[model samples]
Target: MIVARPVWAGSLSFGLVSLPVGLYTATDSHTIHFHQLQRGTSDRIRNRRVNERTGDEVELDDIVKGYDTGDEYVLVEPKELDEIAPGRSRSLEIAGFVDLSEVDLIFLDKIYYLGPRGAEYGKVYSLLEQALEKSGKAGIATFVMRQHEYLVAVKAENGLPTCHTLHWADEIRDPKKEIGDLPGKAKASDKELKMAEQLIEALSMEWNPEEFHDTFQERVVALIEAKRAGKTVEKAEPAAKATGAVDLMEALRASVERARSPKVTGGKAAGPGVIAEKKPGAKKRIRSTPPTDGNGG
Candidate 1:
């Protein structure tokens, strides 16, 4: 396995257990990125930090964080902040453990893989991962990373402890208040509910992530390739327009009928864990159905 460079070096501390660990980024984005430039020209658009009042470009060394305090700004020096940081700001302390599901999905932020700092620390790391996995618990912890103290949850991912930073409780906004006229007390009729459920059943799919594609991104790449080749590129046909929702009952019934009609399933790609195995030459038919790890640290 390819190991990534550690983003932070810290120890996971709990009742008499301090396992030295390093946090490495777990994911990398694959989206194509672009740079800003002047229209019709190659002049790159650049951003520079300048003092708003002085209009002078500021040096990185001279930049310091300041909090607006109504009357004056509270300037905090890095050294001063470090002086009051937890464990001299070098360790992540597990404040407590909770059932993994107890944490709200809304609070989840970013994930990172955790690894033992060295071969000697492997034993403690494995012990913690296994214990948390068996208990169905996650260790709630906090630590400084990139000069900011983050609230995080530690859990196992593929038999190893993984860290996921979370949003502070106060940071989560109430959806009811954020959205206007949300159907807080909306109710569905029994027939409607049943039809909805049946429709979901017909269209249900296995958790095969490979079937999904970033079609837009693929088209963008194709465009770039055509330009590189100096060939005339054909524009893709416009996407099929989405139909308006039908009367609930009609939509559900049609969906069920569509699912029950058998089709060529022999070449259909199955998702992981969808079927134990696929046997070639087996007379497989698609039934129209309707419907449709982590560790603790």
Candidate 2:
């Protein structure tokens, strides 16, 4: 088990079942960083805040967080805000249970791993995971992180519970409002659709995350390495074009074929539970129909 540097510690409760757990961030964005430089002299560029009308460097102490009101007006600090801030600091309190599938994917923000706080808390944590895994449910709760209240979802993950930060429904924009209205018809021919379906079927495979590479980051790193070695950085060649078919159906089929090839087989993968024992010849499958909401969250 990984010893977690917990960002927050609190209780996960639903009905009579309660367990002490800690939240640790699951995702990290620790890629290499770069700074802007003057091209010929290679001098590092530094930012300075100055009024456009009268050029002058602003002192750091003079900075304050503010909100823009209308007409370029700004709302500055208020002493009343300090008085009414949420009392709780770093704590995640589980409020209720929900079917994991009911929450839309767009609501998901950051993810974190929930670990048992101590040996005594292990049994309840395992029990909750087992029960939730069997029932296909997740716990929905509100918690305070960095003094801001957040809606979160805790679900069974690898014999433990994992927490996901969720954005409020109002925070998400409705596509209908932006796109106006979407067409309700299949514009392509039946043959084209059939080819597309076949392509998807051919390409279908288990999710193995290691296969996906952040090519942009990789390219940047390579360029940096080349520059450090006093070598000329080369531009990447254009990607090869697909040769299978010209229509949409052919394109999908080609994609499927590529996906199912031996080169795309196996890599690191994860799901919601521990693999206590491997089931021989078993393959995980995505449900054809959407999961029903499990009421007992």
Candidate 3:
């Protein structure tokens, strides 16, 4: 495998021991991308950063970060933000260790592969990876990168130490507030519950990332290939029929039967039970961690 350039060069320090390391991105996107074009024309659509009031294109150097105060924009210079940014200590200072399970999935963000900075550091690198693996714990550390500091968990994955940036407590939003009209207690019939349990048991299987894939992305690529060949592209398949709430038991029965069927079952694989049915003309959402959103996909 080709090694990638490290995104950040740093050292992981715990107690008095320090291990020089490099943080490299661990994932890549496979989504099909397209350029915008003017309808009915070959002209490509282009976006420009222009002043709304002046209707003039704004240059990158003239742009300043701004915060809205409801009344007006509070213009802030990039240097001002950098001045308050985390120091360039280049050290991932481990504050403590915690059971990996204790850290909620919601808090886990982007992942990066941690590699030894040099040949001499291999022993120490392996030492920490082995320790964390044996103890079943993740070392909690804070590291600064890209003008900001991140709270991260370092743990062993596939014999390699990986660093996972975690969201601060305040950054996590409460689901209760985000989701409204909570459903009250509604008891299901014993038969219904048993059928559901049986359905789950029939569908349960070990995770095999290979078994699942981005079907939508594959479809997009196929479409692009057909267009490039000057051939007509087929229409997308219709979405699964929407069942009403009253059909819950009926749907459950059908699902259970499907899971138990030899033709469909072929032994459970992994990931989602059913692939997502995308609506025609609807936006395609890719599983990617863009820097803006923070929590890495």
Candidate 4:
């Protein structure tokens, strides 16, 4: 088996205990990138760093970051930023542990796999992982990587620990301020709501990421292959037109029936978790379990 390379190496500390660890990227992109070229020509296009005023090419070592202060640009050296970092570059210090459920999903960013740096540190790593799994808590920590400070939560996942970078609290925008036309607590008729709930119940299924694949990417690859062989390719069907408000109730009823049909679900009907007929004055218990992983971060 091929071993993965660690992107960042550091020591994780909790109180007086410290364990050497490394952070390995846990995800990869399947995007097909293309090179820039002149239109209708095979000539490649390239970008270069240059002095804007002189219109001359500049070497990478000569480039320095500049911050504009309205009147003038304040140039700063790369080393100056590193000197002012809050803590040791190789140290990841845990501030405290909090219940995993308490972490707001909005604050999460990228995830990395945290592993012991060497076989000697495996015991320490396993101890932390098991403790976190049993307690159902995540350790909140701060560390510096590549001259940038990161706020991260270390949590246990499938016998390993994963480090999830978190965004600063102030970084999240206020949705009410950002979205002007949000309908706050808009009331719907009980009949329409009940029908909608039944539709949701009919469509509900257990989460299994393995069941899904990127069909669009596959289609793109097919298009490339077809073009290479000088063959025509069929286009995908257009998206279904949305139902109007006048047909909303009819749409919901039809959706519930369609979801319950065996032909629509590969010969198996919707599971027994579906909600029953609405009873008068009964409480509505909608499923509120948000997905654990997504691109929101």
For lDDT, candidate 2 versus 3, the one ahead is: 3
- lDDT per prediction? 0.75, 0.66, 0.78, 0.80
Rank the models by TM-score, top first.
Answer: 4, 3, 1, 2
Candidate 4 structure quality by residue, lDDT tens digits, 1-297: 999989998899999999999999998889877776554344567999978899999999999999999999999999988888735788999999999999999999999999898898888899999999999999999888888888999999989999999998888999999999998997778999999999999989999999987776776676555444434454454569998888999999998999999854221111112112333443431221222222111
| TM-score for candidate 3, residues paired by index | 0.80
Best of the candidates, lDDT: 4
Clashes of each: 26, 6, 0, 0
Error of 4 at 283 (Å): 70
Cα-based TM-score, every candidate = 0.79, 0.68, 0.80, 0.85
Global CA lDDT computed for model 1: 0.75
Greater-TM-score candidate between 1 and 4: 4
Error of 4 at 137 (Å): 1.1
Higher-ranked by lDDT: 3 or 4: 4
In angstroms, how far off is 254's CA in candidate 1?
2.5
Q: What pairs collide in candidate 4?
A: none
Tell me the spans in candidate 4 whose CA falls farther than 4 Å from its real position: 263-297
- Per-residue error (Å), model 2, residue 148: 1.8
Give lDDT tens digits, candidate 3, residues 193-214.
9999999999999999998988
The alpha-carbon deviation from the true structure for residue 265 of candidate 1, after best TM-score superposition, in angstroms, is: 12
